[model samples]
Target: MKRIVAAAAAALVLAAVAACFVYWDTVRSWLPQEVAAVLGAETEDGGGERDRSAVAVRLAPVELATALDRFETSAEVTAAEAVEITSEVAGRVETVLVEDGQRLEKGAPVIRFDDASEQAAVNAARAALAEAEAALGRSQFLFEKGVATEARLETDRAARSTARAELEAAQARLEDRRVRAPFAGEVGFVAVDEGAYLSPGQEIVRLKTTDDLRLRFDLPLEVAEQAAGIGALRLVSGPEGCRQARLLTVSPLGDPTSRTRRFEAALPDGCDLTPGAFITVAAVTGRCPEAVFVPHKAVERRGFESFVFRAEETDAGLKARRTLVKTGVLTGRRIEIREGLDEGDRVVAEGLQKIEDGAAIRPAGEEARR
Candidate 1:
């Protein structure tokens, strides 16, 4: 019985030894050669400073650059003054004086109506007024000589007043037959020909004062407030090129659907921008004179706090020191470092995930040099 128990114990010990050797071989095959060597070295050396120098990263020097935050939006060009010409009185057109695309001064003759009947009425009213005046004069003379009563003299005076009012009305009717330009502008097109009958409020032509233009644009509510302080805005059009415009006014209310505000700017004179032209508006909202900037990859965010790995040179080697940074505007792939960084400071731009605070580093390329 003792001999049988000894043989079983020996078998169990040999089986456990075989299992341990198989596990060791599998683990060794899975590990990379260099990683295995490094692991073996660290284990042999009791995990010393050599493990800290294994991280490789790329570095970039902080640079002084101009940073601008701007708002770009599309706009439309409109004339400073534009109106549709229309007739105020119904009449038969006798003559059309102005042609299409004709520039005219204020009070220039545009159209004339047939005024023969109106002229005859004015003449008849003038004759009646003269007769009433003569009768009034005679009645006054008779009243002073005791030949006419006071009631007769009053009647004569009333007749003269009525005749005068009638004559004035007749003259006004004659004047309305001549249609003239209300303001100085270029005419668009004549809608009526010679002898064409027109009613009141009928469109004649469109007049536009194009010497100066109004640039209309919409901006986001947040950006609109910043744009208000800008001295001038740039208007860009394909055919008219770029021109400077001064802000005139902004809408008091914002659009609820788009959450944008409307703004109008007055363009300078002599620009070839016509009404309804499409344009691009550019306004600089903020600018930094000497902003310190670094590549965006260098910045890492942990919750609300932003930090970067600064490449600090030490007697041992290049070390990555975690630095808390205050950042401003982010333009493209670069970010503005407002605090905790200075120009010419080296920062780790790549391979930051494998590094920690005060970890030794090997720079990847020549970008580390100032």
Candidate 2:
């Protein structure tokens, strides 16, 4: 009975050993190859003949040009000349010569005041002058005939001069009743209509000369320094493409609170832009001749560490090496490569997800492993 139990135990142990050998032998060979396969793909830089087939990478010719750092700023539109019209005389408004929003010529009559009193005064003065002149003629004749004294003739002459002066003064007062435009402009809403009583120095209307419209904006101090020498900057209306302007002035002093420089630009005549319409201003600040740029996607930053991929040819063919790089300004989709790269160095642009360091790869030209 004991020998039968020992035989059963021996058979169980042998069978377990055989099964373990079968599994290990079959899987071990494929394990190394499968694990390294992923590494191989990631390490393959897409430049070599094998790399070209592994991933489709298109190359672009590098060009030399200036790159701008675009900044969006808030701006305001202002009229070049605006004025509030006021009446200078005290009287009843006889007639409002111009309507609201009417374009007026320089020196055009804008408002008329009642001048009947002044006209009546002028008539009275004229009659008085005629009576005085007759008396003066009689006095002169008497003085010449040796009947009147010289003093009496002088008194009659003075009275005639006073009457003439009074008539001239009344006519001048009548002219003051008509208010004319100080300059050519478009009139705003008239505050007082015809027949409204106007006191001295009452506001009448607002007038604006809109021949040259302006767009004023403030820029940062650093940006202003670079653009200070630019005499004229070109302005394109956003999306509308309907208007443009030239630089007018740059303020020497900056705002205390905002710490920004102020600038003004003028639009040409017949421009469709209206005052108070917001627009963008582009100021170019020259170029950097020694700048080297790369795709923004190729750079990866973790903590304080920044890295890029560099492709090189090896005995096993092309491979990607992770390289640490220092970078500069990022203009659009490209970034300036300050270090860790040189001209003509091939880089990986896409398909970096599966790549691993020191992995064996079946690139475009290399044969697939069995």
Candidate 3:
């Protein structure tokens, strides 16, 4: 009786297994594709000859897109005027006229050296010049009156000329004692203090014009030709908002190492940017009014030729047609198909290596829809 019960249980288990096998297709249809595939599902379309051998692939469409002909590159901000401040004459600093980050006008005093000595020297030279001038006048009068020799008049004239030269020299030296700004700008720093000795050519500060800035950058060789037509640009760095820049100039010589051309654009008025600040520049080179774009993965290059597996609908199912295509600008994820492609054409976006020319294919999403 126990053996009879065991045999009946075994028969019931076998019947259940057979029922599951018979309904496996119906069960797989309810499950997800990944789960169904794991359970030995057929990789095919609905009851078609091509579907029996169809390869699973993801599809992307080749459609007309507005291709904005533009490029982005690194750039730097430049000042209208920038100079390193240094004293022309060595002296003891009487006072530092400017501090770090000070705004000043042209000819504004940056540092005042010990000008007392310079002033005294200038005064003495002026007195000597006045005396020499008086003596020269007297000597000229005497010579005219036959009371002085011609050689005496000549000597007086020479003395007067030498005195004038000495006075001018003293005045120049006095001017050197007070270091002034060459242009209206903001100063970086004043390194010296009152009563501190400063050597000639020692950097006192750096003066840079903060407004009317410019952008300088190198443009690629391919787009450098359009530098002329690209008159305006947009800067992508600095501040919260973006502003436009006008084309200033392009260097005649190209960079040998980068194989690019240098470009400069003038920033607008009231710009907050300063010299040496880095920026990103965007410029429009050209535009393609009508262009067929495809996913970059769909296109592959073998040696000299480039090709894409485009999906072609047939009575049996979809087939991958290995179509040769001419490629254009490849920016980001989309690639421009210059030739051999049109709008509404579907191309394989994923699993490109698994499929070959004329290979049967089924859209991976088709299973989910069914």
Candidate 4:
């Protein structure tokens, strides 16, 4: 009786296992790759069995060549000398000497404030100085003629010195009411009109050098250290082919908030870039002579790991072998494959995400890779 019951239980267990096998494809298709693979699925992309049909993809061969290794970043076009004009003393505006967009040289007057009282004080001080000088001359002559005492001459001399000092003080006050350009530059909009009162340090107008232009940018600490070896920056966007800008300076101090260092480069002469306009810049960090590189699209990033699908020919056709790579410097359109690939190796540059490990592929490399 016991043997007969055990045989019936074995038959029921075999039937249940057969039923699960029939639905294995559909059930595991909805599960994660790890769970699905353990449960009879056979793929690496976290899915069910991968399709055997080939996916059309463009292939880029790895090359051992010399290429620029650059770090690309956006930079702002700026005038080498730029400042906003401001008043140094409080007064009512008398005249606006410069109009909007007018270019002025250093020491050129931009605006003048009301200086009637200052002018009067200057005139009075000048008259007192002249009077004191005349008295000293008279006293010197009289002393030579024995008609004036030494004490009298000395008193005249002291009075002349005092008067001279007073004149200088008055003139300096008068000049403070006039605003002059500190450097040669074109004026922006005139901020004040006639009869408008302005306080000390109030803005009058903006001045920016027209021809003297620079490119200003920021880079992180690591990239900045690499940029130290480069002599120039490439202007990525321009009518002419990538123009070179002369490297000027990098700030000694770094910004604590952004953790970046400021960099400035002198733009090439006759380059008609507007001030305050932004332009893209790329700086070469280093160059590789015999390094392996592939198209930028050939690499795929999964989480923190970067991968490339290398195309290998097999008896059936071409198959994709997903490879883990270590990357180096990146230029414009290509990235350095420091590891995981060799020269002349083929990689699926386009349609990287549609396939996984051991997936079939069709190479469609019609256009030449530059």
TM-score of each: 0.58, 0.56, 0.72, 0.68
Candidate 4 residue pairs in backbone clash: none
- Model 2 regions more than 4 Å off: 1-65, 69-79, 126-150, 212-215, 238-246, 269-279, 291-370
lDDT of 2 by residue, 116-215 (tens): 9988988998899999999999999999999999999999999999999988888888878888888888886688888999988899888777676777
Residue-pair clashes per candidate, as listed?
A: 0, 9, 0, 0
Tell me the spans in candidate 4 whose CA falls farther than 4 Å from its real position. 1-64, 220-222, 236-242, 252-259, 268-274, 295-297, 302-305, 311-321, 326-336, 343-354, 357-370
Where is model 4 poorest over a 10-residue stretch in terms of lDDT? 33-42
Candidate order by TM-score, highest to lowest?
A: 3, 4, 1, 2
Best by TM-score: 3
| Residue 197 error, candidate 2, Å | 3.4
lDDT string, candidate 3, 232-347, tens digits: 98876656544788998998878889999988899888777767888787877788988899988889999999999999998878999999999987878999999988888999
Candidate 2: what lDDT?
0.71
Order of candidates by lDDT, top first?
1, 4, 3, 2
lDDT of each: 0.84, 0.71, 0.84, 0.84
lDDT by residue (tens digit), candidate 4, 1-370: 9999999999999999999877776787687543443333224434333222566577888977786667888899889888887888888999989998898989999888899999999999999999999999999999999999999999999999999999999999999988899999889778999999998889999999988889899999878887866798888884374388988899988899998999999987788777878989886787778988898888988899999999998987889999999887776698888899997789998878788899887654333212
Model 2 vs. true fold: TM: 0.56
